[model samples]
Target: MGHLFSKRKSRVTEHDKALLQLKTTRDKIHQYQKRSEATVEKDRQLAKKLIRDGKKERALLLLRKKKFIEEQLKKTDGTLDNIEKMIQDIEFSQIEMQVVDSLKIGNESLKQINAMLSIEDVEHILDETQEAVEKQREIDALLSGGLLTEEDETAAEEELDAIIADAIQKRLPEAPTDVENPEVVLPDVPETLPEAEKKAQKEKVAMAAS
Candidate 1:
């Protein structure tokens, strides 16, 4: 939340100030150039008028002054170009500074993370976790009558098999435990049945076959 509300610090530096000053100089030069151009044109027109009025020396002097002002204006144009190049260099330098600052921040963040989770620290945490899991398993074994143990995997397996067998036995029908002996009276056995019974038996056999 603090980060969300915080304002970023200004990145402006000496280079920016220098650039502003240079631009100011360039603008002043531009104004001077305009004034110089106006002066040159005025001189040129005055010189022509002087020549028509037969003041040849004065017209020549005015022409000389006009040439000097044009030279100065040209020099100012070169200066303006240099200033523009300087401004571009300063701006590019600012971008470079930003890149460097970003790299520094990334490096610092990595350092902090490494410090927090060093190799030794991570190894220690893993060992503690393994020990805790082993202790929990022991506790569970004690609670379950020590039937489960890491060192005795066969015992745990045998216990599971026994439990399954018990479940199966419970699901099966119980066998009769009480036996009653009954006497049977002997009856006469005839070698043949009556005609109707014999015929009915034959029809039942035929139906089953079909």
Candidate 2:
């Protein structure tokens, strides 16, 4: 029975048949529109010939026929547009169905995940881990005899300070009191330059002047 049901589900249904019918109708509409366009052109040429032959009334009648065919062409085009859009909308709706099903599955998975994990549960685990770490540290300190005495720590800090001061004093250079401050002179504003530098300076001044 299940196999038979699966077979029936695989078979083409009313919707598939309807879509095929719509496609056939759309093709027929296209053929009719093309024929009508040709008829409009033919009537236009006939009207032009009639006008040339001085039969203005006949020419106007032929033009009227052409206009009627043009109207039919417009109707056929509108019908074709509607049918094509309907087919496209139907096809897109199938995709939307699949997307909805997929979203349902994703939401179910998230629900399952949420069922397994809660905020309070996570916080409890984190608190336990923190307590475990602090306890481990306390145990280690107990085994290793804990920290230095206050007097021993003070003496160690003083020794470190002395070592850093001695290092700084050895690395420092003597102050030079005779060093002059450099003058801020523009390249082109130098009154005189050395012989080799003068040529380059003069060229810079010339370029600046230009």
Best by TM-score: 1
What TM-scores do the predictions have? 0.49, 0.45
Residue-level lDDT of model 1, residues 1-210, one tens digit each, is: 233325568876788899899889989998999899999999999999999999999999999999999999889989999999998998899899879877977777777778878898999999999999999998997888676456586775555445544544565565433345334434434434466755565555457658
Backbone clash count, each prediction separately: 0, 0
* Over 4 Å off, model 1: 1-7, 113-210
In model 2, the clashing pairs are none
Model 1 Cα shift for residue 79 (angstroms)? 1.9
lDDT of each: 0.78, 0.74
RMSD of each: 15.5, 22.8
